[model samples]
Target chain A: MTVIDVRNLRKEYGPHVAVDDVSFSVEHGEIFGILGPNGAGKTTTVECVEGLRRADAGTLEVLGLDPHADGKRLRRRIGIQLQESQIPERLKVWEALDLHSSFYDTPTDWGRLLDDWGLAAKRDTPFAKLSGGQKQRLFIMLALVGSPELVVLDELTTGLDPQARRDTWELIERVRAGGVTVLLVTHFMEEAERLCDRVMVIDAGRVVAVDSPSGLISRAVPEQRVRFRPSAPLDERLLTGLPEVTRVSMTGTRVEVSGNGDLLHAVTSVLARHRIVAADLRVDQPSLDDAFVALTASRPHGSGGSPGASEGASDHRRG
Target chain B: MTALTKYELKLFLRDPAATLIVLVLPVGIVALFGVVMSPGGGDAIETFFPSAAIALGLGQLGMNLLPSTMAGYREKGILRRMAGTPVHPAALLGAQLVVGALFALVSMALVVAVGVVAFGFGPPGSIPAFLLTFVLGVMSLFAVGLLVASIAPSGRVATGIGVAVFFVSIVFGGVFMPVESLPAFIADVGDFTPLGAFMRALRASWAGAWPEPLHLGVMAVVALGFSLLSAKMFRWE
Candidate 1:
C-alpha cells in the first residue's frame, strides 16, 4: 500500500522557490530516503508531507488522508521527528515520552519504549544532560510512543559521530521491522546506501533521480574499473580490443582497464590467453557517493530557479 | 492537556531562580517593608508597601518570566514540534498561560497572607473588588508579555525587552514610591498604564474605597486591547 502520495508539490519562500513540482510516493514497510545538498528541497518536501508547512500548489496524501485538510487526524497516524527541535531542558527522559504519549488517543507503553530504546537508565536524566546519541534515541522513542503507522525522521543523525550514526541506522531498521514505514531525510550517501530501500535525490528544488541505491549508482556511472599488475610486460592493445573494455591506461607497473559490461571477465580472459600472470588485481565498483556527485553535478545548468541558476553559473565559471 | 500542564508546572518548579523571583520575592518584600514601615498605624500611604509587593510579583511573572519562557519554547522549536503532533500547539500556549496565572495567584496570596498575619497589615476592605482588579491586572500584564513573546526573535531578546518594560512599569506604577509623591505628570501617565492602574485600584481596595473610574477603565482597556493584539501577532514557530 502507498503510505504517502505527493504530486506536484511546490513551496516558495518569498521569491525563492524551495520545492518545485517535486513528486514521490512512499510504500508501506519501506525505508524511503530524501537525499539532497544543503539548500536542496528535501526538508521542505518532507515538511509538506508532515503538514508542518503548507504547499503553494500540490496534493499530499499520507495514509489516504489529505495532509492539510485532515491535519489533526493525519498527525495521529503519522509520527514525526523534526530537525533542530528540542524538548524543554529541564524535562526528564521519561517525562517527554510520557507526555507525548498522552497526545494520542491510543499510545504505546512508554515504559516499554524506555527499555526498547536503551534509555531506561537515563529515564530520570534531564534533556540537556543527555548525550547526543541518547537525545536522538529519546526523540525516536517519542516519535513511536504514539503508535504511529508511519514515522518521518528529518536529519536524524546529522551531528552524530560515526558509531552513533551506525547505531541509529540499526534502530531505524528495527523500526521498519516493527511494521512501520519510515521516511528518512539525510545528506549522507552511505546512510542512504545502507538503509534506504529507495532514494529520491533532489537538488535545487527539483527531483534529480529516484531509484534504489545500487540502481542509482549504475544509472549515473555505468562503468567499472579493473586494475592489475602483470608479472610480465603487457601490450595495451589486447585490452583495448575487447568488446567490454572502453579504455585502457597504464600507471607505473599497473594496467588499468575501464569498461561497462563483463569488464573484469574480458580483461582477465585476455591476460590469460597471453600467459601473463595478472597479480594484485583490484576491481573498483562505483559507489553511491560517486553516483550522487555525478548526478547532481551534471544537471543541466541555468534551470531558471535562483539556487539552481546561481550554483550552475558558479560551476560553469569553475569549469 | 492535563499531562502537558502538569509537565509545564514541573518545569517551572524545576527552575529554582524563577520560583524564587515569582513566589518568594514578593513575600520577602512585603515582610521587610511591613516591619520597617509599621503599616499597622492605619495610614493610607502604608497600603503602598503590600500593594506594591503584589504588583511586583505579578509584573515579574506576567512580564519578565512568562515572555522569556514562551519565546524560549519558540526558539527551541518546541512549539513547532508540538504542531507536528496530534494536539494543536495552542494547547501548549494554553498550558503556559494557565501555569503563569496559577503562579500569579499563589504569589498574590502569599504576599497578602504574610502581610496580614505576620506584620499586622490590614486586610483588603472589599474582597470582590480586590479580586476583580487582580484578575484584570494579570490579564493585562500577561497580554503584554504575550505581545513581547510574539514579536521577539529569540528568548534572550524577549527577556531583555520584558525586563526593560518591567522596570519602567514598576517605576511609574507607584511601586518605587506612592503615586502622590511622584511628579504630577508622571502620576497621571502612570494611571493610564496597565501596572499603574492595577496598583492604584489595589491600593484603593485595600483602603476600603472604590477605585477611580479611570483606573478601572484603563485596566479593562489594556486587557482587551493587548490580548487582541497579541492573538493577532502570535507566531507558532
Candidate 2:
C-alpha cells in the first residue's frame, strides 16, 4: 500500500524554484531515501510533502489525504524530524519532550523514550548543553513520541563518528520493524546505500534516478574492478588474455584488473599459475557513491543535470 | 481564543522581568512611592494617597513592564516559534496586551490597598468616581507601554525609552508638581497625554463624579489603535 504519494510537485520562492516537478511514492512499512547534495531541494521537497510548505504546483497525499488540503490531519499522523531541530536553548531536554508531546492527542512516555535515546542522565540538561549526538538523539526521540504512522527524518546523521552512525542505522532498522513507513532525506550516499530499500537521487529539485542502490549502480555501469599489489612490478601481458579480463592496467606494482565478476579469482589464479606472487589484494566494486558522483557531476552546474552525470567522476578502481 | 490567552498569560508570567514588573514589583512600588507622597494630616493622607497609587501604576507600566515583555520575547525567538504554530500570529499581539492589562489591574489593587493601609487614601464620598479614574489611568498607561514596545528594536532600547517616557510624564503629569506652577505648554501637553488625563480622572473621581469622560474615551481610541499597529508591525523570524 502506498502510504504517501507526491506527483509533479513544484514550489517556487519568488523567482527561484526550490522544488521542481518532483514525484515519488512511499510504500507501506518501507524505508525510502531521497539522496542529494546540499541545496539540491531534498529538504524542500520533503517539507512540501509534510505540508509544512504550500506547493505552487503538484498533488501530494499522505495517509490517503492531501498534504496541504488535509494538513491538520496529515500533521497528526506524520512525524517530522526537520534538517534543523530547533528547541528553546533554555528548555531542558525532558521539558522539550514533554512540551512537544502536549501537542499530540496520544504521545509516548518521555521516561521510557529518554532511556531508549540514552538521554536519561541528561534529562535536566538544557538543549544547548547537549553534545551534537545527544541533541540528534533527543530530536529523533521527540519526532517519534507521537507514535506517528509515517516518519520523515531529514539528514538524520550528518555529523557523527563511525560508531554513532552505525548505532543510528540500527535504530532506524528497529523503527522499520515497528511497521512504520519512513521517508528519509539525506546527502550521505553510504547511509542511503545501507538503509534505503529504494532511493530517488534528486538534483536541483528533480528526480534523476530511482532504484535500489545495487540496481542503480549496475544500471549505470556493469563493470567490476580487481586490484592487487604484486611482489614486484607486474607485466601487462600475463593478465591480457584471461577470459574474465576485459582490460588490464598496471600502475607500478598496483595491478588493476577491470572485468566482469570472478575477475579477482581469475587474475589471482593466473598469477599463481605463473608463480607470480601478489599481495595486498583489494576488490573495488562500483558503489552507490560512485554512481551518485557520476550522475550528479555531469548535471548542469546548479541546474542539476541528468542522472548518471556524476558516474566515473570519482577514482573508482577495484583491486 | 481564551485558551491561547491563558497560555500566553502563563508564559508571560514565567519571565523574571515580567514577574517583577507585574506581579511583585507593582505592589512594592505602590507602597514605596506612597511613602514619598504622604503628607501627615486629616485630609493630606487621603488626597495624596490616590495620586501616589496612580503615579506608581503609570511609572512601572511605562518604565519597567511592557518594554521588557517585547524585548525578552524577541531575544528568545518566542514570537517566531509561535508564528509557525497553528495559533494565529495576531493572538500573540493580543497576548502581550492581556499581560499588560493584568499587570495594570494588579498595580491598581496594590495602590488601593496601600492607599488605605499606610495613608488613608480613598474617595471622600463618591465611590464610583474614584474607581472610574483608577481604571482610566491604567488604560492610558497600558496604551503608552504598547506604543513604546512596538517602536523599540530590542529590550534594552525599550527599557531606555520606557524609563525616559515615565520620568517625563510623572514629573509634569501633576503627581508632585501642580499644573499652575508649570509652563502653560508643558501643563497643556501633560493634560492631553494619557498620563495627564489619568491623573485628572483619578483626582476628579476623588472629588466627585469623573471630571472628563472624553479624556478616558480618547485613551480607549489610542490604546485600540496602538495595539492594532503593534499587530501590523511585530517582527518574527
Candidate 3:
C-alpha cells in the first residue's frame, strides 16, 4: 500500500521558494530517503508531510488522509522527529517518554523502546543532563512510542559522533524490521546509500533523480577505473579488446584500465591468462557520494532552471 | 488531558525558583505586612490590608507567572512537539492555564491562612460571593497574561512585559495604597482596571455583601475580551 503521496508540492518563505514542484510517494514498509544539500528544501518537504507546515500549492496525503485538513487523524498514525526539537530541560527521560505515550490510543511499551534505542540507563536523567547521543535516543524513543505506522525522521544524526551515528543507523534498521515505513531526510550520502531502499536526490527545490544507490551511481557516473602494477610487461591491446573495457593505458610498469561494466573482472581475467601477475590491484568504482556531489553541483541552463536539475529529466531508474 | 496536566504539575514543582515565586511569596508578604503594619497595640488587621494581600498574589500570578511559563514552553518548541501528536497543541496551553490556576489557588489560600493565623482576621462574610468574585478576578488577570504570552517573541521579552504590567497593575489598583487615598480621577480609572475591580469586590464580600455590579461587570468584560484576543493571537511557534 502507498503510505505517502505528494504531488506538485510547493512552499515559499516570503520571496524565497523552498519546495517547488516536488513529488514523490512511499510504499508501505519501505525505508525511503530524501537526500539533499543544506537549504535544498528537504526538511520543508518532510515538514509538510508531518503536517507541521501547510503547502502553498499542490496536494499531500499520508496514509490516504490529507496531512493538513485531517491532521488529527493523520497524527495518530505517523510519528515525527523534528530536526532541532527539544523537551523541557528539567523533564526526565522516562517522563518525556511517558508524556508522549499518553497522546496515543495504543502506545508501544516505552520501556522496551528505551532498551531498543540503548537508552535504558538514562531513563531518570534530566534532558539537560543527557549527552547529545542520549538526547537523540530519547527523541527516537518518543517518536516510536505511538507505535506509528509511518515515522518521519529529519536529520536524526546530524551532530552525533561516528560511533553514535552507526548505532542510530542500526536502530533505524530495527525500526524498519518491525514493519514501520520510514521517511528519512538527510544530507549524508553514505547513510542514504546504506539504509534507504530508494532515495530521491533533491537540490535547490528540485529532484535530480530517484533510484537505488547502485542505480544512481552507475547511471550518473559512467566510468570506473582499475589500477595495478604488472610483474611482466604486457601489450595494452590484450586488456582493451574486451567488450566491457573502454580504454587501456600504461606508464612504465603501472597499468590503468577504464570502463563501464565488469571492467575489474575482465581485466583480472586478462591478466591471469597472460600470467602477468597484477600487483597492488585496486578497483575504483564510483560511489553514491560522487553522484550526489555531481548532481547537486551541476546547474541547468536557460531561465528558471534548478541548480540541481539533471542533464535529462525523468531519470528515475527504480530498483 | 489528565496525564498532560500531571506532567505539567510535576515539571512546575521541579523548578524551585518558580515555586518560590508562585506559592511561597504570597504567604511571606502577608506575614511581613501584618508585622510591619500593625506593630503597635491595635485592633486586629483590618479588611483592607488582607484584601490587598489577595490582590498582590493574584496580580503576581496573572502578570508574572503565566506569561513566562507559556512563552518558555513555546520558545523551546514544546508546543510544536505537542502539535504533531493526536492531542492538540491547545492541550499544552490548557495545561499551562491549569498550572497557573493551581498556583493562584495556593497563593490565595496562603494569603488567607496568614491573615487568619498571624493577624486574627476572619473568613470572608459571604463564602459564595467571595469565591465567585475571586474566580472572576483571577480569570481576568490570567487572560491578560495569556495576551502577553501570545505576542512576546521570547521568554525574556515576555517576562519583561509581565514585570511592566505587574507594576502598572499594583500602582494603579491601590495595592501600595488605598484607592481613596488617590485623586478622584485616578481612583475612577483604577476602578476599571482588573486588580482594582478585584480588590473592591473582594473587600465588599469580606464584609458579607454582594460586590457592586460595576466591579463584577468590569471583571467579566476584561476576562471575556482578553481571553478571546489572546486565543486569536496565540501561535505554536
Candidate 4:
C-alpha cells in the first residue's frame, strides 16, 4: 500500500519558489529517500508531506488522508523529526518522552523505548547535557513513542561523527524492521544508497529521477572500468577487438579496459588466452555518488521545466 | 494538555535563577520594606510597599521573563517541532501562560503571608475585589509580554524589548514611587497605561474599596487588545 502520495506539489516563499511541481510516493514498510543538494526543496517537499506547510498547488495524501484538510488526524499516525527542531534544553530525557507520549492516543511504553534506544542510562540527563549522538537517539525514541505507523526523519545524522552516523543508520533500519514505513530526507548519497529501498532525486524543486540505489547507478552510468597491471607486454588490438571492450589503453605496464556487459569476464578470458598474469586487478563499478552527480549535473537549466519531465523521458527510453 | 503544563512547570523550576527571581525577589522586597515601614501605623503609604512588591513580581514574570522564554521556544524550533505532532502549538502557549500564572499566584501568596504574619500588615481590605484586580493585572501584563514575544525575531531581541518595556512600565506605573507624589499630569497619563491602572486597582482593593471603572476598563482593554494581536502575529518557526 502507498503510505504517502504527493503529486505536483508546489510551495513558494513569496516570489521564491521552494518546491515546484514535484511528485513521489512512499510505499508501506519501506525506506524511501528524498536525496538532493541544499536549497533543492527536499525539506520543503517533506514539510508538505508532514502537513507542516500548506502546498500552494498539489495533492498530498498520507495513509489515505489529505494532509492539510485532515492534518490533526494525520499527525496522530505519522511521527516527524524535523530539521533544526529541538526539545527544551532543561527538559530531562524521560520527561520529553513521557510528555510527547501523552500527545498520542495510543502511545507505546516509553520505558521500553528508553531501553530499545539505549537511553536508559541517560534518562535523568537534561537535553542540553546529552552528546550529539545521545540527543539524536532520544529524538528517534520520541518519534517512536507515539507508536506511529510512519516516521519522517529530516537530515537525522547531518552533524554526527562517522560512527554516530553509522549507528543512526542502524537505528533507522531497526525502525523499518518493526514494519513502520520511513521517509528519509538526506543529501548524503551513501546514506540513501545504504538505507533507502528507493530514492527520488530532486533538484531545483523538480524530480530528476526515482529508482533503487543500484538501479540509479546503472541507469546514470551503464559502463564499468577495469584496471590491472599485466605481467607481460600486451597488444592493444586484442582487447580493442572484443565485443564487451569499448576502449583499452596502456599506462606503462598497467592496462585500463572500459566497457559494458560482461566486460570483466571478457577481459580476464583474453588475459588467460595470452598467458599473461593480471596483477593488482581492480574492478571499479560506478557508485551512487557518481550516479547522483551524473543525474543532477545532467539536469537541464534555464526555463523552469515541468514536474518529472526528464524522469518520464528516461523511463520511456528504459522501457 | 495537563502533561504539557506539568513539564513546562518542571522546566521553569529547573532554572534556579528564574525561579529565584520570580519568587524570592518579591518576598524579599516585602520583607525588607515591612521591617522599615512598621505596618498597622495607620498610614495609607504602607500599602505602597506590598502593592509595589506584587507588581514588581508580576511585571518581571510577564514582561521580562515570559517574552524571552516564549521567544526562545520559537528561536529553538520547539514550537515548530510540536506543530508536527497531534497537539497544536497553541497548547504549548497555553501551558506557558498557565505556568506563569501559577508562579505569579505562589509569589503573591508568599508576599501576602510575609506581610500579614511577620509585619502585622492588614489583609486585603476586600478579598473578592483583590482577587478580581489581581486576575486582571496578570492578564494585562502577560498579554503585553505575548505581544513582545510575537514581534521579536529572536530570544535575545525579545529579552531586550521585554527589559525596555519592563523598566518603562515600572517607572510610569508608580512602582518606583507613590502615584500621589507624581505630577498631576503624569499621574493622569499613568491612569491609562496597563501597569499604571493595575497598580491603582491593586491599591484601591487593598484600601477596602472596588477599583475605579477607568482602571478596570484600562486593564480589560489592554488585555483583550494585546491578546488578539499576539495571537495574530505569533509564528511557529
Cα lDDT tens digits, model 1, B120-180, are: 8999998988999899899999988999999898999999999999999988888878898
Greater-DockQ candidate between 1 and 2: 1
Whole-model alpha-carbon lDDT for candidate 2? 0.71
Off by over 4 Å in 2: A124-129, A156-170, A219-225, A240-246, A259-263, A285-287, A302-319, B1-14, B39-104, B119-215, B226-236
TM-score for all models, in order of appearance: 0.96, 0.77, 0.90, 0.96
lDDT by residue (tens digit), candidate 3, B37-127: 6632333335677788778877877887788888988898888888778998898879978987888887788888777777666678898
DockQ, cand. 3: 0.69
Which 10-residue span in candidate 1 chain B carries the lowest summed lDDT?
A: B37-46
Itemize residue pairs with steric clashes in candidate 1. none
Docking class of 2: incorrect
lDDT at A242, model 1? 90
Indicate the docking level reached by candidate 4: high
Error of 4 at A64 (Å): 0.9
Model 3: per-residue Cα lDDT over A1-319, one tens digit each = 9999999899988878888778999999999999987787898899899888999999998999999999888999989898777888999999899999999999999988888777888889999999888888888888899999999999999999999899889989999999999999988888999999999998667778888888888777878999999989888889878998888888888899999888888889988988889899999978889888766654433232333354544322111
Of all native A–B interface contacts, model 2 reproduces a fraction of 0.00
Please say which candidate is ahead in TM-score: 1 or 3: 1
Record all residue pairs in model 3 with backbone atoms less than 3 Å apart, i.e. clashing: none
Task: List, residue by residue over A73-187, the lDDT tens digit for candidate 2.
Answer: 7777777786644564666788777766665677888799899777899998987898877877887787787778888888889888777788888888878888889898888
